[model samples]
Target: MKVDVQLLKDICEAPGAPGFENPVRKLIIEQIKDHVDEYSIDNMGNLIAIKKGTKNPDGKKVMVAAHMDEIGFLVSHIDDKGFIRFQTLGGFDPKTLTAQRVIIHGKEDVIGVMGSKPIHVMKPEERNKPSKIDEYFIDCGMSKEELEKKIEIGDPITRERELIEMGECVNCKSIDNRVSVYILIEALKNIKSPAFDFYGVFTVQEEVGIRGANVSAHSINPDFGIALDTTIAYDLPGAQAHEQVTALGAGTAVKIMDAMTICDSRMVKFLKKTADSHQIKWQPEILAAGGTDTSGVQRMGKNGSIAGAISIPTRHLHQVIEMAHKDDIVGSIELLIAALEEIDTASWEY
Candidate 1:
């Protein structure tokens, strides 16, 4: 099946910054409710959808996690002149915020721009330094009285960028994890006759930490776990060969390890074998820094789980113009479905 770019666009465009994941959570529920046997939102705002396994007599569960949240900001204060001070909800490169547009989700959605000092007035020494996060503020372009009517402190703010098709990829804000969200939804709908029951969890607070995945995985305690997320594709120019984590159009990533967790070896081998048997293109991922929901899924269970991850190779990650290849996106979905169907065939003994 081909990629559904429209559905992916809708998923990426929906704002759900860290703890403020209500909007995108709702969108995921709408798309998957009818496809799953059952689905529910947890107390911590994770959306869990379950599909019963047709072939399992052992009552095994496979938990697949895809975080629903994105890196964003929260209003901290509104200045007397209508400039707004904010705190970021997740990691951000300060320079990427320069003059970027954002949406403030308060009493109503209000648009603002990241305001910073113009280089024309900067001291010669200042112009050479990288921008600092604290040096920026939001410009609402409205009077303080008018701004107060629609915005206030603690309201969530999100990057403003629409998904667009590049030559061979999709570019948009929140592609870091939103592309994984799209993959999980498609896999849930497409997988038939899985080897074990599947718990498709669209998690929250992952951009902050794996908080939502930790809670949900603790509750599910599955026999197998796979975290679907994006990893850096430093395949761009001016990079050494060893430094490229993965590349656009390279294929779906089979996680070896990241800073937070070393993936279960058995699960890693199973993913690779399954992909080869199915002839799905694949790559190995070793993120030197950063992590995904894999950490929580691997250790939060009662006995811990045989966990790994399927990472989509993405460039300009955590930035507004994050990008991923459509081919890699489709490869991820294929590999996930193949794994669920063939899990019973793999040797799980370590």
Candidate 2:
């Protein structure tokens, strides 16, 4: 099955930093509203979509979560020279911040360039060390008075980059989670009669923590949950063999364990079995660090629901030029659709 490249590009390009996901949420709702039976946004801004099963409306409830937020920054202080100092909202490699273009969401969308001192004038010790994030500032080419009039503290800041095709892979900012959101929407459009009542949740504030998933899972209390997100693929030139958590073009990753949760054994087996039956490529993911919405859903509800994840293998995760293979994206959608169709609570093992 061919993935929708256009939709993927749209989601990746949209701005939806943590705690500020209205732009991406609106786009998702517009695409999925016609396909679902009912949909609404939660108090925490999670877009909850319900697609009823043809067999039973009260059938097993299955929740599929894909966060809409991305790593970004917030304006903390604007100095006299119109240089903006920002507080990082999510984890960032200080190395990636220097010389990058950003969009500041203030009174109006303003373009700014991240700047730092030239290495030519740096001390020997300073040149050998990585630059601190605080040492950098954003230059909007405006005076202090002009900048203060259009911008204010607490405005969101995001890396500015459009999606680009790189051979078989695509590169852009926000691909970490937006790719999974694209997968979920595509699966919902293609799947026919599912065995369970499906809830496609576009969660918010996942970049900061799994806050949105935590709340939605508690309210839905799904029988089974699958969190869709991206896992870091260290298949690079310098990384060692054992350090490679996943590889680019390796297909969808079926989560075994991460820092957050150990996948339910039954869910793992089911996903592998489904992939084999459909001839969809897959891999086992054992992430050393990092967490996803899966942890939140697995521990939610009265008895806790069986939970797992289908992750897209991404290279240079959280960077402005994040990359994901197109084939792996399609594989994730195929595996998810197949698993949803076969979600039979009676047949699932304890």
Number of the top TM-score candidate: 1
Which tens-of-lDDT digit does each residue in 59-102 have in candidate 2?
67889999999999999999999999999877888898788999
lDDT of 1 by residue, 91-163 (tens): 9999888999999998989999998999999999999998899999999899899999999899999999999
The candidate scoring highest on lDDT is: 1
Worst 10 residues of 1 by lDDT: 341-350
Weakest lDDT window of 10 consecutive positions for candidate 2: 341-350
lDDT values for all models: 0.94, 0.91
- RMSD values for the candidates in order, in angstroms, are 0.6, 1.2
Q: Give me the overall lDDT of model 1.
A: 0.94
Off by over 4 Å in 2: 56-58
TM-score of each: 0.99, 0.97
Error of 1 at 200 (Å): 0.2
